[model samples]
Target: MASNGMESMQLAEDQIKILEENFNRVSKHPDESTLMLIAAESGLTEEETAKWFRLRNAQWRQAEGLPAQLGSVKD
Candidate 1:
């Protein structure tokens, strides 16, 4: 029930395809330049692309029985 917005975001078929393509190409953390390029090509903001990758990676890690923070660096 947290309200961070975009919870109701419904991507169009084209947008979904674009995102899916990018996701498959870079399931792990993508660099800022690549992400920005993807965002521009997919008509999404960099933040949205980053969030999508984060959530997708979390799901992937969960399925693989790995910690969600596996590749993340801790301070």
Candidate 2:
């Protein structure tokens, strides 16, 4: 569990590598089918994969001096 009382999910190093490679080389806003494939490749659920992409995109936007909430994942 996390400090916030929610279950904490930690990705293994290999999983992180997989996700990072995809994020760098592929579309940031992946479609549903792509999300399914990524989830399978990373050994995560579709929901988890989508959440990871959402958080990663926000971080990327923030790093680029853009608002974290500037756009939706569907954008």
Candidate 3:
């Protein structure tokens, strides 16, 4: 069971790497339509996509002294 769980995690990590690469290639711009379509194709709900967007934005915001708290934005 432990090995199976580890294998699953590894597979998920590999898949995420592939997806990130593909997304980077396709996501030339951070347009809403494109990201939403990609999110749908990538099996992400709008909420999940929003959360990811907020988190990514927050990381950048933190560097620039912008608000990035989870409560500061909707997920």
The numbered model that scores best in lDDT is 2
Alpha-carbon TM-score of each model against the true structure: 0.72, 0.82, 0.43
lDDT for 71 (candidate 1): 64
Q: For each predicted model, how many residue pairs clash, with residues at least 3 apart or on different chains?
A: 0, 0, 0
Estimate candidate 2's alpha-carbon lDDT, on a 0 to 1 scale.
0.81
Candidate 2 TM-score versus the reference: 0.82
lDDT of residue 9 for candidate 3: 31
The models' CA-based lDDT, in order, is 0.73, 0.81, 0.52
Of 1 and 2, the candidate ahead on TM-score is 2
Best by TM-score: 2
Q: Write the per-residue lDDT of candidate 3 for residues 1-75, one digit (tens) a residue.
A: 123122233325544554465445764334777667756765666555544555445555667796655464253
lDDT of 1 by residue, 1-75 (tens): 354333455667787688778878764778999899888988889988777777667667768998866765631
**Candidate 3 least-lDDT 10 residues:** 1-10
Q: Which rank order by TM-score, best down to worst? A: 2, 1, 3
Candidate scoring better on TM-score of 1 and 3: 1
Candidate 3 collision pairs: none
